[model samples]
Target: MTPLGPLLLLGFISGHLTLTRSAKILTVVLVGGSHYLLFDEISHILHESGHNVSMLVQLGNPRIKGVNYTGRNNSYRVISWSANEEYISSFNSWFLEQQKSFFEGSESLSTFLKFMGHLALQCELILGDTSLMDSLTAEQFDIVLIDAFNPCSFLVAEKLRARFLAVHVSNFWSWYLAGLPSPISYVPAARSMLSDRMGFWERLKNSAMFLGSWLTERMLYSQFDHTIRKCFPPGSQPVLSELYLKAELSIYNTDFTLDFPRPLLPNVVYVGGLLSKPARPLPQDLEDIILTAGDEGFIVVTFGSMLASVNLPVVLEQINAAFSQLPQLVIWRHLHTHWPSGVLPAQNVKLVDWLPQNDLLGHPKTRLLVTHGGLNSLMEAVYHGVPVIGIPLFGDQFDNMVRAEAKGFGLTVQVNQLQALGNAMATVIEDKRYKASALTLSHIHRSHPFPPRQRLVQWVDHIVQHGGRHLRPFGLDQPWYQQYLLDIILFSLAIVSLAVYIVTHLLKFAVGYLCSGGKLKVA
Candidate 1:
């Protein structure tokens, strides 16, 4: 055959072949964890959607260390770094110190900053690791999901050249960092114990606390910036303010029902119970205990993971004392296997190192929960329609309990008040309104337009498609003074000053003219 005939046959053979392309699956990297529960839930959801998700967590995190990560099909890969365990221990120790240590240290501001500094220091364990950073950069993640708690994650994301950044504040009321309105006139600080409704004097105190905390935190961020530059080889130093401003999406672990009505940016989403899942079947022994309680019901007590370090033997004693008189069986999730000689458990009280809290709260026999008012525990109680006796120690716990009280579903006792525990527990148990209110809130929470997980995923996808740049308000771009319109105030003051000066000068001139023209013509 001729050469032209052979070429035509080869073209016909090539036309029979088909070409195919698959959709690009986004790669998401989650860095930073002291609050792994929130991150874990989000990572799994993203992974299930066929996206590649990896988490770089601190080995020092007790929650992350305890969880089992090995399995078939595997939810997500967890990469961890072992920093100094002492850093974690010291941070925990600070929480357990007398509450006075927080308010009366060298300077309460400095003390608070130091605690934050310790957390920032932990980030160095990941940021300074050249090998890990190289591997992460090679993976070329599409986005970086960071716990708002660790501001240093900003550096990691920048170094990896990630396309987008999303921050999840595992707790509520993210201070001024989120660029959302948190008016001191009504909205309380994250750590504050004040309620949204306050008297004039109380509002003044709140304002002072707010201003002081905001200023101090700004100073703290400077220190964090220094650490970020020192730990990482720095060409481009990202200021903390820039990170907050550039954040494509920010999620707070707070619901409007629990939080005060404050103006929020479109970028901010409240997903309070995102970590919550349907209660799993309880252990056989624990199930037996609940079943035995019958109509009398049982009380669940837990101060969360930090309780093991809390030195408040007095608080434990009061809790025990109160349970002794109640008809309800008490299930106290005490971390220690043995109680001190001075600490005695009531006959009706069972002390276990851990409890399936969600399952326990959902049980028919769980009448009341005596909690430290941690957001996680409070949301669980609200989710299950259980009343609470809140003894908040610090951080957002106090504000959480205050919200519960305002909603009529719970009451708070002073952390150290031995006498008030009995009354608090009695009120929660005897009052029917508490249970009714809790049920109402539970219904409202369940009936929200979007479940927490769905809201989270929707926002993540929204940011991926839209880049979320429009969600950032113009207010964030303005300078601090301009954002508050201080210039307008200054201009108004200048105009008033000029008007007053002109009036005074005109009066002087009129008097001078009359005197000069011999107004003594009356003679």
Candidate 2:
């Protein structure tokens, strides 16, 4: 509506400022192996959206050029993290607490504090090594989104006064996030009790857990906050502190298709199926074998990427005994040596170091799935509507297997119990309910509220493009003392008020007594 010359100039300037600005540098801080699943999807999204992406993974894998390093395997990574004596000692103490944890519901206050202490220490060291320090020193990033487990990366963002978002690689409430979820339950990655959704009893248990867990984390943050302040001078500089104070957004790497009846946050975007997308093409030989299997039907056996290569000879024997009997040919993803030389490669069985998991699952003739119940594998099964026989080893596998079993799409049998393994597999393969249930679940999985990868990319790009002001965690901006809701302060005030009232009454009584010549009672 302005004058012609001025309006034209203003529009041109606006377009030039926005459209011609240099691309922003987005620094992504990934904390674990699973974090790859989340960032992998977001990476393509960000690049296409016109931002430069640099990744800082604590345990980097070479597959991603941005990742700085990779572990030889899970054991090697575990060893690397354990190299620190205090961390090793503390981890050992918490690691063995699994039995006690099962009885107590989830991690208790001491257990959680111990776990957090180890994680914070490990993250700090790992972050420094991953070139995250370089990004911070350069102050090059417009936004830093950290997978939440690595609180140290958050510390780094806070150091640089950059806007940050917390990325959760696992299920919601499965890891500790400050403020949200209420009362602060100790929901470790593998909570022994419920998923993010809580029932009446679960709510009660979590309420207690929240109180205890809150105290422990409070103590943990106290130590870490000091280190954070030291890391960035004038973290005291209110301007910088204000900018870095909160997480811009939280992204949940889950497809609503797979996770149901699970409570989630409005801010949380489920991008779970991101990992299920096509990556490298399946080898030709592998493709042929899978296509042939699809013709008559076959069962796929996988123990997930981490645990499959697990050197548990006993578990292998148990699985072998059961798979050898199915009507369908077995496609086994074996890690250690070729299916135990001469165990008789039955015409109905095929052995390989790996299989094109998604392709195979998507193939029509795939009949059954025998898994270790890792979340990624479990979700894949749901997406494909394949019946599952779960042999849970540890972590959330047990809970996942239990849920799958309860859902009627699968059955759970402990790896140690070979008989249970055989029986459960027989039931799922033969029973109609499991198959029907699997199909129904597949329908739900496919019918999720949105396209997972697209949503993930959308939200991720939103943060980078908008400069992160929209996604920051507003809760922590308030003081910790306020968050804790310190009743002690209230009690102290009440006591002072009561004391003044009593003292005033007593002085009046004394004055009246002296005037009337009555003695006061003294104890």
Candidate 3:
């Protein structure tokens, strides 16, 4: 061949190799709300990075209505299994009832266990669908990224027989599942709502919470096990806990700048603020409102997506009353239709059906954020250097608020204490310390060598290109007793006990001989 012909052939070969290097990634989205958003973000990132990405969306929650389950606008394909309308209505009703119980302070262990049962039912529905399973198996995905909030994702990964990575939306569950060391002496438990700096009683409470959480997790696993056995062949059924350890990596949606310092394995990566971006110009209407507020600025109030659906008239009145006391404009995320019949929003408060949360937080005129303490919102607040007043509702929200408060960037008021909402907002807004700490945290979070999205994409690419087996710790494969070194401690204790028994006998015999003037005493 001529020189030019050889050069053209070489370029063609290089392009082919680059295309072949792209991995086929299947993201399992079982639930919705923030969990779906996180997985969607990951799918898009991987797809943008030249990977073949597909999303497997199994609708489990009715609350996730109107979401684009399919990657319609994206280049990747989407395979979705939507639940029946009746089932969706039932699930939505049950979920709202649970929320009501939580607001009324009547939520019990039984209610939580019942919720776990609901999750199991949803998993069972997906697994029972033969066509869906066949379609997923045919894809032959290279790896799976699972939302670790629901145990069902583990079973899905197992059914696909693919190496998987877990995306933990909160700070704590993945640590417990992956056998990562979490010292209850300082590290707070999942929903304990306690900070790392604990006195004696607080530490005891943390320890108790950890044990309770472990037990609850086991119970949840057992519920999933029934589905596993029912769906899979006898020998092929995989243990949920084992699948958790089998994850190549666990990406936590948290950062140390916002979360308390804790032990992490090499395979664990913190990719908080994946959805955060630089502020874009707000719509003219919102801009005009901000301008009208002058130097007093504005406050953003949102109780997250799901909580916005909940109707707490008393709580709403209290919030409106509190916002009325402020000089700043309050842009609250609440449906105009859902507004209470008689109650009216304060003159300073602007009620909208939806608001651009990240954009609002990033705005120069934004002063404080009144949130329900979702991790995503908190991370955005930290990213934008905005102080918060958390009105934590449930789940990890309480713990997240605790961390925010411990970091000195915010404070929390319980839902029952809506009366304190105004005062808490005033404190965070007036005190320069909170804002300074938030700015410092933002600096630390942004000062990383690479951004969180970059870290997520790079680490995921690294794991997919090269298996993460070497990155996993040996302890992940060990039994619980071995992981804690309980077996070694027990063996050492046994040896020490035997030696003491012999030594004590020898000493007694010597004393008896001396006392008896060299004559042996008969028993």
Candidate number achieving the greatest TM-score relative to the actual structure = 3
lDDT of 2 by residue, 4-24 (tens): 988899999997566434344
**Regions more than 4 Å wrong, model 3:** 1-20, 60-72, 521-523
**For candidate 1, lDDT tens digit of each residue in 1-523?**
8979989998877643311111122222332222665676667777775567777766554452112232225777776766666766776556446343421222245665766676577666667888988988887666678766667667667667675555554454565767887778888765567788899988988888887777766887776766767775666667777777677777788787666677778888888887556788888998888776778899998766545434345656766888898888899876554456678688999877777778889887888998878787888888888999887765556678889998889998875465788877888889899999999999988889999888876677666666777888888889989999999999999999999999999998788779878453433
RMSD of each: 7.7, 8.4, 3.5
Cand. 1 TM to true fold: 0.85
lDDT of each: 0.71, 0.60, 0.85
Better structure of 1 and 2 per lDDT: 1
CA lDDT for candidate 1: 0.71
Q: Compose the digit string of candidate 3's lDDT tens values, residues 1-523.
A: 8979988999999966664478989998887778877777888888887889998886656333223233338466778887799988898888888776666556567777787787788888888888988888998998899988888888888887888999898876447777788998988887887888899999999989899999887876687767888988998888888888889999899998998888888998899999788888888888988899999999999887666666778868888999999999999987777678878889999987778889999999899999988899999999999999998777788889889999999999987888898998999999999999999999999998889888988887788778899999988887889978899999999999999999999999999999999999787
Task: Provide TM-scores for the models.
Answer: 0.85, 0.68, 0.93
Give candidate 3's root-mean-square deviation (CA, Å): 3.5
- Point to the candidate with the largest lDDT: 3
